[model samples]
Structure formats: structure tokens, C-alpha cells
Target chain A: MNQQVLIQAHQRIQPFIHNTPVLTSRLLDEIAGAHVYFKCENFQKMGAFKMRGASNAILSLTQEERQKGVVTHSSGNFAQAVALAANQLGVKSYIVMPKNAPQVKKDAVRAYGGEIIESESTPIDREEMADKIRIETGATFLHPSNQDEVIYGNATAAMELLQEHPDLDYLMAPVGGGGLIAGTALAAHYFGNNCKVIGGEPSQADDAFRSLQSGKIEFNDSVNTVADGLRTNLGDRNFPIIQQHVERIILVDEDEIIQAMKLIWERLKIIIEPSCAVPFAALIKERDNFKNKNIGIILSGGNVDVKNLPF
Target chain B: MNQQVLIQAHQRIQPFIHNTPVLTSRLLDEIAGAHVYFKCENFQKMGAFKMRGASNAILSLTQEERQKGVVTHSSGNFAQAVALAANQLGVKSYIVMPKNAPQVKKDAVRAYGGEIIESESTPIDREEMADKIRIETGATFLHPSNQDEVIYGNATAAMELLQEHPDLDYLMAPVGGGGLIAGTALAAHYFGNNCKVIGGEPSQADDAFRSLQSGKIEFNDSVNTVADGLRTNLGDRNFPIIQQHVERIILVDEDEIIQAMKLIWERLKIIIEPSCAVPFAALIKERDNFKNKNIGIILSGGNVDVKNLPF
Candidate 1:
């Protein structure tokens, strides 16, 4: 995908999404010795940046496909995103979920008007369930983070950030399913004026980090980080873009992630998910590299359970 | 005192304080049965609306007064507000705190460049200590929410909300020492098109509510609410304004406050103090009155201790 594709994705989803605000804190700036701008995607619809990709993918469907509906498999924010986006667009959405998924998540999907088809608690099972629904209903299947349109859609968040603050020295986003960071890397490449792109990943789930070092796709053995959203490995659609455009990926430990998450909550006074905090944690882990630089971090989402906070 | 006062206050504090973003949530609006706009003073400097008044009060001082710095007696956000306001203006601030004040608060005040003067943990002792410091250092003693300039400063938060959403049928703020509610009432009177101002008071600290009924100031026998920022009684200066301009006071209990606070944290995805939740609780308690009408609530602060959350 090119810059034109990113621009078109933004235009398509403009009415369906919020151009989330950029927040700053002097106390946090002093703590990190850098001027930091946080693009708060936590305030986005359904409380995550996943909404952008979901909205873009759904909006790009043919009129016939739209009438038939959309299908996706997700045990997380994507389920809510696709459901809500489809509902907003007046299209039907079917979400394939693992039976063991949290009741709250299931309730959220339903609340967003998504029809859930329960699958066994496995990736292969979820995909099979989604495929069955697509075939039965003549629906369009939307990959959460592994398609050109989804990655192009996610790029708009960073594009808006750059439009507002074009002089940022570094743009950072967590390395989740690679959609967000890949989009962010492309955003910095096309829209930014020599701004470098950095990826923040949990050490326990360091697929993106290893993939960049080895120059190919990599898999994780233990998907055991508190940043549950970032456990997924990079996809073929986004991995090549990340390799070519991403400046570097930094790995942060679980404790460091929790500590950084607490600081963002306390100092920024905004609720952000643990996955969202991974990049900010990485910046803090090796702050010497960012000292006095103008930095921007895309806070991926704010869907954490306050009752069960890691802190 | 008038529209001119609020206009000047906004201009004076514009450089020092943030014109904090007004946030909205479709979920909250649907739940509350009204179109609601949240004037988020929780995102204001010092993480509370107190900064608006503190900055206005500090800026309104004479050149001579500003030179000697400012003084206040508080065990909470006001102390930090005065400290930071003073520091921002490159002036020294002396805060009279109770000896038993939280160490974290004391640290926050000091970090904001405020000098601490410890006093016995009583209203009488704190006032006496503040008076002594004022006499000794010639610093202007700023009341937390009692004086005219401070109240006018507090009014600017609502003035801003009204400017952004002028068609709001009602503007609500939590009643504490009466500064915020009094100022809000005045703002609605001057800037709104017949917009009514509502005050939310804790049943445990129902002074403002009772004062309105009595047509004079009243005091609560007990101030046993989790909303610690709202325990103080109305002062003579702000009570008259409240009686004259405020439409009514709504009493919310502790449980309602905590429930609304949780909903805001979970749905709005922002950190707000318990005191900030009182007005929303009152709105939800009496949603029928606000059904389909445009409502605005000033979120008071975001200074709650996360570890000690009621929910």
C-alpha cells in the first residue's frame, strides 16, 4: 500500500472514528527528560485503535458484501471494534469467539450488536469458525491486523499525530499483531519529516523484535506477557513493511510494563491498557536514547479492568 | 462577580492553565438519558479545576503581592494548585498544612516548589498558622474557595464549558467550599441562554443544600464522605452568590458517588476523583429531569489515590 491508500482509508473512516486528542504532561516530560505527545486512542470508539482498522476494512466492502455482512474472529478489542463499526455502518457483523473468553468480552460484543459464534479456545478453531460463517452467510471476512486495508487504516492515527506535530523526532507504538506499528512506521515514512519509527514489544512476546533482527517472520514459544493484546505474532501482510520502515524494536520486561503503565495512569491521568504501555515502558527503560528529544507515543487503547489493575 | 470578571479570568489564566478538552461518551449519554458534555477539569493542571481559580487568584494579585508570593491552607489539591501556580509565575508559595497530612501530598506540594509550614491538624490551627505566615512573609493569603477572586477564577471552568456548548440546558458542579458551584452559577447567569446551574453535594456534607433552603449559610454536623475534597462548608462570600444564582442543590450518597465514579472510569476511560463523580451521580439519580435535555458537568479533579478506590 502507498501513501494514497493511507489517505483514502482515513477519508473513508473519518465519519466513523474520532481523531483522538494528543495529550502532554510536564511532570512526565521531566521524568523522562523528553517532550512527549501521547495520541490517546484509548478514547476511540470501543476504547482502542482497533476501531480504525475495523472501520476502514468494513467501509471498503462492496455494496453486496456489505449487505451480506462482515465476519471476524477475535477474543479481544477487535470483536468489539468490528461489531460496533458494522453497527454504526448499519451492516450486520458476526464475531467468532473462544468459549473460554471472558464473560465481559462476550457481553461487550453483544452490546455492540455482534452475533457471536463460539469456537474452541484455539486460533485454528477460531479461524475455522469464522470461515464457516463467511461461507454460510456470504459475508466478507475482515482480518484484525493482517490485511492491506486494515494496516492502511491504522496508519491514519499516526498520520493525524504527524499532521498536528510534524516535528516529532521519534514516533512510537507497541508491536502487537504488527498492524499498528507497521502502519505507524509507514506514517512516519510518508508523512513525517525525517521522524524515526520505534516499536515497543514485551520481552515475553518478542516475535516482532526477533523478526526484525532475523529479517523474517518469527514465532513466540510462551505468549506469557501481561500485555495480553500483544501476544499475537506478526503477519505476512505487515511484517515486510515493518522490516523496511521500522527503525528499531525495544523489548521491555513485565515488571517494567506494569510500572510504566502506573506512571501513565498517574501522570497522564488517562486510563490506558497494558499493551498500550509497552512502548512507553521501553522508552523509560532506555531513556538515555530519548533524552530531550521530542517523542510521540500512540497509546493503543484503554480497555483495562480497573478492578484487576496490575499495579 | 459579573460576565466581565469571568472573561478577564479566562484571559488571565489562559497561559497558565489548560482549556481542558470537553469529553463526551455515547454510552454515558444513553445511560443518563441526555446529551451530556463533560468539561474535564480532571485533565487540568494539578489534575483538578482548582488550578483555574488558583491561577486566576495568583494572577489577580497586585505586583507587590505577587512579589511576596501566595499562601493557602489545605491538605489536598488546592495546596498543589497554589504551589504550582506560584511556581509557574516564578513566585514562592507557602502552604500551611496539617502535621498529619499525607506524606505524598506533602511531597507533591514541595515538588511544585511550595514551602511547607506544618500546623496542628485542625481548622483553627491551620488558619492560625496561615495567618501567621501571611503576617511574617507578607504573602497574600488565598482562601481555598472562599474569596471573590478565587470564585471568579473557578467560574472560568464553567465559562469555558458554556462557550463550547452554549446550548446546554443545565450546568452541574460538585459543591464543596462553594467556590466552584458559586462561580458556575454566575457563569450560567451571564453566559448561558437561561441555562440553570445545579450543585451536587454529599448527603454527609449537606451544608450547601441546607443553606439554599434556609436562605443563609448552613454547616454540616458531620463530614464523613469518601469525597474528601468536598468536606468544607460554604464561606460567607460564595454562599450569597449560590443562594442568588444557583437553581438548586442535589444530594448524592456515598454509594451513588462510587458507582458513578466507576462508570466514568470504565466508560469514559479517564481518571477522575470521587468528588468529581458526585454531580454525575446526582444527574443519574434524577435522569428523568434531564431526559433529552443538553447537560454539562464539570469533572472536578483526577487526584484520587488509585490504590484506595472505593469500587
Candidate 2:
């Protein structure tokens, strides 16, 4: 929760993660009416910012704990993140997924040395199976987002961005489980030159936006957004950080997300997922609010199915 | 082309173009069975390597010629390249695009300050219109791929790659208008540590491969290839250079091009045009020929229409 913890976490995970580049486009800058700097975590190892948190969590474990391995339940980027990080650190990883998960997703996890434990097509089923694995094998149960070490680890991305462009007026990131944005808020508070942190979320899954307004954790009744990454609810650990540090959560519609994503793909020549485009969509919606200012955007990941692109 | 011209071209275009990054992938290395280095011209200004040649051609113009401006006929990356380069040099650019050319492409040219002069949907019509503009305005007619200055300019890409990794055993590039590969061969000849240059081409549009074998300029009977950029025939200015310096031309089918492209998109997390994938396709096809060797591959461009992705 403090700057020292975040700093140490960054140092610990430094050797394992890439200090990904900050890219700028003149045309993009013109369209947004701001000097936009893109922190490209899409180019990170395992192709997301999740690698930082996973590496930090796995490395923080003791030799005996590492020998017993780690277990997590997710069908998204975190699965690959933990698998790759654990493999690199010479530790075993047990990934629990629903039986209906895509073959490609399961293959990717296995490719990174994850032992898959399939369960019924439900969250409770996944969690119970992961817990059973942890109890039976004495493996550490690592939460994908709602963990202190993971949040601190995720802060390193904004830390690197602030180090490169300290004069940024605002730092924008897409809110998934609030891990990346909470860490970003911490980074901006400690290292930025009076920079404010902002979060972007889909209106269809606007739990983070309502949570900020109500000053409490909120959950969507039904998730109907194309941003598959942002469909998860904010966690207890990250929700408190979000309430205290995050400035505001902006809501964008599905069309705007697709438009912003297309612009990045066409103008910046980079592949970014729908969740990554949420922040840029917010920028476009409120261009007048931040016109001519310097902004840093976290391109969260680039792990989309290319064959099923919306635009 | 000689070393001195390439060296001087690099110096002349240094301020105008980007010294694009060279990226490496461990997984990609394992798949190709070679230590692969990719020179990312996809990240270059105008999102293609054509900018290098365009800038060189425009910068090489005399003062009077600069006052008169420059003209070219095409609807591909070259149109945008010449427009952007001329705009940067403060010279007028007249772009003759076909009437049936895609609206997105024409808009790109105009966005770069090109004066669009539409002609009938035929190569001869475009050339005639460009020739008419040249006569009317006394503007210099710059061929997209057949000119000496442009070829020398394109060579700077391989020059940079060699400078960064001089011990490369082989250099590979996709053959389009023959500008990039001809220049790459010359660069390897002059700056490399005895590096052999190889060319990749589609069998559907195998003019360069046939031209190299037949000892003369040859044309494809029907240019039925998805690699839209490599459909042009080799020209007089570049054929001799290619013949003398290039080690071999490898032909790949359409399926191979798409497969290689998907692999790059999925693994490298970068968007590249189909033409750019031809070289990697060649490398993948001849994996045994390149195993355990250090090879440098030029990723030609990243200007694909996202809506029409073949994958």
C-alpha cells in the first residue's frame, strides 16, 4: 500500500519483465488534441501487463513454497501470465479452467508449462477445483487480481511511463479488475509531477464507474460488453485503492471502443485488444476536457483472436 | 549502386526517416530454426520502408526541381510515401491515383498533402496522366521502384541491420517492385561481413524469380497473388543490381504467405501487410537451409486494411 512496497516490487520483477516502449503518433496526437504517449504493455512478455504481477507473486514465494508450485483459476490472460512466469522461475503452475474453454486458450496455457485442471462451466467450479489442487499439493493459491503483491507489481508499468515522461498531465488505463489502474494511481501519486490517474470502463459493464460514484465496490448484473477482459468485477483489495486514489471512471459504449481500436490499429500500426481501447475511447469522448494536454495511456494487452476482429 | 552512395544516402535521409528498431523473438527463432533478427520497417514513418526511398528521391532534387515539385503514379504505399516525403521537404507532390482505387488509400495520400489527380482504372492511364502533369508543371517524374536514388535510399535499411548485427550469415527481404530487395542486396554486398542476400516472392507473381533466371526483365502472365505489393515487374535500373548481388529467390504459395503472416501477428504482436510476410514464408519453407544460422529479415510494412484480414 506504500511507495516502498511498490518500489521493491518493481525492482524484484525488473529482470523478468520488459521495460516496454512508449510510442507516439503525430496523427493520433492531432486527433485526440493531446500529446498522447502509449505505454505498450501489448508488447510485453506473454503479451500483457499481467506478466509483471505474476512474476512478482511467484518470485515473492519461498523456496519451499515455489517447489510446491502455484495455483490460479482464470480463462483469460492471467492463465498464460502465471504459466509463463512460473515456468521461467522454475516453479510449477496449476491452471483451473472451465471445460468449455476454447482449445486455443487451453493450448496456449499448456504451451507455457501449465497443468490444466478442468471443471464444470462455472466460476464456483473453477475456484473449488483450484482450491482442491492447492490443498492436495500444498501449492500457493495466488489471486489473479485481488492481491497486495500483484497490485504493487502492476504499478511498475506506470512507474516506467512516468520515468520516461514525467510531465504527463494525466495517466489513463482501462479498468478490468482494478489491478492496473489502482497500481497506476499509486505510481502517479508517488512519482508523477502532479499527474492525475483516470480509469476507463465499458458502459455495459460499468461496475467500476458506479463503484466510484457510490464509494463502494459494485458488480454488474449482466456482462454484455465486447471487452472480454473488463467483464470481471473489482476485488476487495484493489477496490479500496481505487476509492482512495483513482480520480474518476469514464464510461464508453461498444461502438466507441471499436472505433478507438480501429484508429490505433490503422494509425499506430499496433495490435491492441478491445479492453486496451477503452481508455482511448474515453479520451475521444472528452477531448475538450483534456485538450492540448500531455496524456499517458496504458495499452493493456494485445491477445485478441485476429480472425474474429470487429472492425 | 555502390557503398559510397548508400552511405551518403543514409546520411542524407537520416533526419527525415526513422532508424527503426530490430526485434528478436525466442519462439520465432525456435520455429524458424535460426537465430532471427527482424528489422521493423513497419514502424517507419508512413508505416512502410517506401518513406526512405521517397525522402532520398525528394532530397536529391535540385533547387529548381524542388521549386517545380515532384510527381508519381500509384495507389499503393508509394503514393503516401512520396506525398509525405515531399510535404516534409516543403515541395509540392502530384499523385495520380486510379479512379477505382480504394477511398481509404486516396484519403491517406491527400492527408499527406498530395494533390490527387484521378485517372482511368488502368496502369497506362495512370502513367499518361502523370506524364501529362509532368509536362504541364515541369515536375520531376519519380518512379516508385525503378529509380537509382530510391534504390540507394532503400538500401539504408539493410545497412542499419548490418551495422547492428554484422555477423549475420544471411539477409532476407521480400521482392515487390524490386526496390527493397535490390537495395538490400547492395547493402549486404557493401556493409555485411560476407553476408548472402536472399529474396522471397509469391509464385503467383514470380516475375523477379523468373527475371533472375531468364537473365532479362520478365512479367507475370497474370498477377493473381494476395501480396498486392509484389505484383510489379522488375525494372532495368534494379534488375542488374539484383542479378549481381542477390544469392537466390525463394518462391512460396499463397497459403504459405497467410500462414507466415498469422504466425507473426500471433507471436510477434505486430501488424504487417501480406507482402511483408513473403520473406518470412520463404524462411519458414526453407527452415533446413537456415538452421543454426544468424539471419536478418526486413519486415517491409504494416499498412493492411484491418477489415479485410486474410487470417
Candidate 3:
């Protein structure tokens, strides 16, 4: 939206989030032939940038809404973020997850004080179940990535990065539901010094990339990608912002994603999930276009199942 | 060693080292029943605290010695630390690693611009090879953990930790060749508010603990431990420091180490090597002794081969 709304969202959610560190690696820089600054939201509270959005959404609610509680149907980082944020604000959270969702994800949500409502492993089932819970309890239904408050809240991370390094030439992030990239674009537009925002999307799940080309929301018919987090399609609330501000969307193959993920873990010595590596993969693939430029990559999250590493 | 030496070491190596972040996890603190502060050396320049000691050793060298270069025999963190530090300081480094050392370690040393010399897979063979190289090239042979300069270099970690939180009730580190623990003890003695230093040694490789009781430098005749980094015995230079200042040594088993390592990986959302988990393992094992106290644990390194994770 506007700079004022972004600032207000940050002010409201700052107490509940971590101003995560920006990390750099010489080897990584040398490999990509650019000065790469990683805005490590992997180290954020609940280990993702989603925490900022979750906190802001809950904090924006009225006293009556807060009393009723919040509801979200997510089997990823956003689920944990909302649960933890609500718990911190002393508000109840109802998380509707798929019946076949990873046990680790379910455990993490419960650990953060979320009440689980399991549905059949389908998008329709998840949405209907969450809607039922919302109707029953009169709870606020918060979309993981498509809400206005969430997008403005996510903008704070890039805002903080801009605050530290105002002259960054390019800001890059993976396009998963188009939320993070949209927020990053807004932050760069309002705060950066001649900065452009770029999105990295997996070729297997290329809905966001297609959405940009068609100037309309698109969906993947059959998603098949290793980056489990990037399979979701774009939504109306954030798609317009992305279309207006995002410079380009780079599509990378699964192999490149795995290579990028391994490099971060080995050189940066940080655990980042497959979705987090997508931007770096794109950077590597398009090194000539960005050679020697100052780049900022949003490492989206670090919640990987160590027992099932692809590398 | 005195506080002056520790301060001097930090000043000398400050340009070449990182003031790594001190991380806190509510879940980890709850598990330990103490307010635990993790001095994350895993995020250091070489992904370990060995960088501090290695850089200090190189920086402390005479002009002629610097020209002649430095050498060490290590198959672990110190090898890469020495290689990278020497490269950073514009000094040549010769690393004599055992033939059976992991190929990934060799690649890391070479990537850091160190000349590698392969020796037979034995302690004696590795030392003889390194000593021969030292004689041939007239290079200073810097022992991985036994030398005074290295110990003072290592002390800078605890010094930095104390600089951030000087009121810590205790400081904990894994006992490998006694260098880190010994340096930690010296730092706590001089800089902390009555902070007692504690050592975490694997019960399988309990040389340091036994040496304290026997009043002599002891050896682990059959070191059978999952903590490959802590298999080395206490050395002459650091044994006296450990004996004089360390409050107590905690010995934990293999299962406990794995559990502690998993907890840190899961809750702290950081990738720590098995060796780095030793101090936390000890903390979790001895929660009663540290309950409600402010404790600092030195996360030794994060160089585990992700291909073969224990958990």
C-alpha cells in the first residue's frame, strides 16, 4: 500500500518479531560474481518472515475479533508463525492442517499452542474446515500470504535491510503465492535508492511467473517440484502489487535449486529449506546480468526436515 | 595467561575474525533449566572458533616467521581455520592431514589456499609429516590446540561473550585437547562476574576429566566416542589452566549428545556439528547444577557432513 501503512505495521509487530541478521559469505559472493547480502529471515522468530505478517494481522484486529480468536489453514512456515504470534498476544489460534501433513509440521504448530483441526488432504477440504471453524467460533480468517496486513507486515524485513544498506542495487526473493516478492517490491519502492525487486520461481510450479506474463492470476494444473513451499499460486490481494513493482521473474530448474541450497549450507553454514534457495539459484543462473551488482536475497525460512535431506 | 594477553589477542585478530552473535533459545533454556546463551562460533569466518586461535597464532608470528610461513597437522576445523586465516593475512599455510581424513575437509583446505600434504592415517605419522615439512620449509609448526598463542586466541571467544554479558554465572565448552575449555576458564576468571568455567567431555573420551583427578596429563587409550572432535587428549600447555581454574567437568554419553544436538537443531533452528553439541549435552545432562543461572555455551563449529547426519 503506502509507506505509512508499512511503518505502522512494523511498529505494531516489532515487539513480536526478530530484526533478523543480514549474513554474507565471501565464497558465495565469488561464486555468483556479485556482492550478495542475505537478509536472513531464516533466523526470524518462528524461523520465517511469516512471523511479521502473522503478528501484524493479529495485532490489527479489533478487541472483539481478538476475543473471538484467529484461524488459518497452512501446513508450512505460516502455520507456525500464526500459532506462535497468537500465543504471544494471548489470543487463541485454530490451525487447520491436512491429515497427511508432515508430523514435524503438526508438532511444531501444536508446540506453539495452536489447536489443530485436521481435514482430508485436499485444498477444498482444508478451506471448508477452516471456514466451518471460523463460523462456529466467530474467529478472524487470516490468509497465509494474500491479506493486505500480512503483505505490509512482510515489507518490514526489506525495510530493515534498506535501513542498513540503503544503496542496494537489487532485492531478490522467491515467488511463493507472490506475497514476499510483493512486499519486498513495495519496501524497495518506498525506501530504497534506485533498487529493483526480482522474483525467482521454480519452472515446475510456474504459476506466479505466468501470472506476470498474462497480467492476471494463474494456477499450475499439476505442480511437481522439490521446493514444496513454492507450489502455491498467486492471489488477488498481492498480485496487482507484484505486477506493478516486480521487474522480472526468473525460473530455475530443480537441480539448480538443490545446488544453491547445498552451497548455502556448506559455505554460509546455515540450514535453509529448498524454497529459501530459489532466489540464489536464479542469481547463479543469471549471473551475467547481475555480475558485480550489489544484491540482497531474502532467505525465506529454515524449517527443514534434517532426516530427509535431498543433498 | 592473563587478561592482558586475551585482550591483546582479540585486538590482534579482530581484523581477521568475527564477533559472532550470542543466540538465545527459550526452548533450549527450558530444557537446560537455565538461561543459556550460545556464543555461535559456527557463524565465524571459518565456521569455528579455531579461526580465533589460528589467526592469533599467525598474527603473533615474527616478520621472518611470517615470511617463512606456518604449518599444522589437523584433519578437522583447525586445518580449515589455519588455511583461511593464513590466506586472509597473506601468509602461506601448509596442512598435513591424515590420508583417511574426509575428502570434503581436504577440498575446504585447498579452497582456502592451503597446500595440503597427505600423511599416513595415524597421529604419529601426521605429526612426523608436519615436522618434516616444517624443517624443510623452515615454517613455524603451529599445533592445533596445545600452543599458548592459540589458547589466547581461543580465549577471545569467551572474552567477546563476556563483553556482551559479563554477568554470566557460568561458561561451558567442550574439552577436546583442553585448549577451548582452558581458554574459557582464563577468560571467565578475569572478565566474568564470578563466572565459573565448566568442561563437557564425552564419557567415552574422558581424558581431561581423568587428568584433573590424577593430577597429570592423561590419555584416552581407546577413545570410542561419537564426538570425533573431542577424541584428542589434554595437552601440556592447557592442562595446567584447566586444572587451576575450571570448576568441574561434565561427562555425557552418546545418546545424550545426539538428543541435545537434535534439540538445538530443532528449536534453535541452527545447524551445529556433533562436537558443538557436547557442551549443550552436558548442560542438559546436568540441569540441576545450572538451573535458573545465566550460562554461556560455546557452539564449537558447524562443519558436519550433511550427507551422513547422525539424527
Give the best candidate by TM-score: 2
Residues A144-183 of candidate 1 have per-residue lDDT tens digits of 8999889988999999999999999999999989999999
Q: Is the docking of candidate 2 incorrect, acceptable, medium or high quality?
A: high
Model 3 misplacement above 4 A: none
Please provide, for model 3 over B86-149, each residue's C-alpha lDDT reduced to its tens digit, 9 standing for 90 to 100: 9998899999998888888999999999999999988899999999999999999998899999
Q: Write the per-residue lDDT of candidate 2 for residues A1-311, one digit (tens) a residue.
A: 57888889989999999999888999999999999999999999989999999999998999999999999999999999999999999999999999999999999999999999899978788889999999999999988888988888899999999999999999999998889998899999999999998999999999999988988888987789889999999999999988888889899999999999999998888889999999999999999999999999999999999999988
TM-score of candidate 2 versus the correct structure, residues matched by position: 0.99
TM-score of chain A of each: 0.99, 0.99, 0.99
User: Cα RMSD to native, each candidate?
Assistant: 1.2, 0.9, 1.2
Q: Report the lDDT of model 2 for residue A241.
A: 86
* TM-score of every candidate: 0.98, 0.99, 0.98
Ranked by TM-score from best down, the candidates are: 2, 1, 3
lDDT of 2 at A252: 96
Candidate ranking under DockQ, highest first, comes to: 2, 1, 3
The weakest ten consecutive residues by lDDT in model 1 chain A span A1-10
